[model samples]
Target: PVVSDFKILKNAGVQEKESFHPLRWFSLEQNYPNPFNPTTTIRFKLPNRERVWLAVYNSLGEQIRTLTLNTLNGGTHTIVWDGTNDIGKRVQSGLFFFRLQTKEGALQRKMVLLR
Candidate 1:
């Protein structure tokens, strides 16, 4: 390797962030307003582009609503659940679990919906 003379450029450009930090693993964050009445937001992160499956299930582990079933880019994503079922019917108030699935694996979290 040969070292060539180089000069530092002053204020050439600056990065928006000090450093770029990408998601290292797939994960699901807890839904905001855990005990929600009408709607709640679900957030997840993907290290790479992949097919995603987000759904809500009852305490019995029965899937009631399919929030998202598509391919998403590698980044943080969010979806809103309006406390409804697959058929657009409002569900009863109780403790429910939401699951996020991708090729990497699966992650689930609990949320409650109140009528």
Candidate 2:
């Protein structure tokens, strides 16, 4: 469902300069409960507004899930994985990698799931 109404604004003869500072890009944090079961949380920080993609890969280097977010504002955001694959089926206990991709770059972290 559409949540917000689109708005149109007239140009105010001003263009905001994109910051080249280190803080302008996005960042990813390690998943909590390093060794998780059923579920886990992943936190990230987007210092500047932009689109992003979060994905999960198995130990065999095959993608298991892909999460895409539309334009998001700059700041911290959190997402959760229920230890399931893209098809909504539970995955086996093993090592997995979760990666956050953005126009700026990509970040990945390792996690373990216990049955």
* Count of clashes in candidate 2: 0
Indicate the residue-level lDDT of 73 in model 1.
93
Task: Locate the minimum summed-lDDT window of 10 residues in model 2.
Answer: 1-10
Shift in Å, residue 61, candidate 2: 1.0
State the weakest 10-residue window (summed lDDT) of model 1.
Answer: 1-10
**TM-score for each candidate, following the candidate numbering:** 0.82, 0.77
Candidate 2: deviation at residue 55, Å?
0.4
Pairs of residues clashing in candidate 1: none
Q: Candidate 1: lDDT over CA atoms?
A: 0.94
Pairs clashing within candidate 2 = none
lDDT tens per residue, model 2, 76-112? 8888899988899999999999999889889999999
Which residue segments of model 2 deviate by more than 4 Å?
A: 1-22
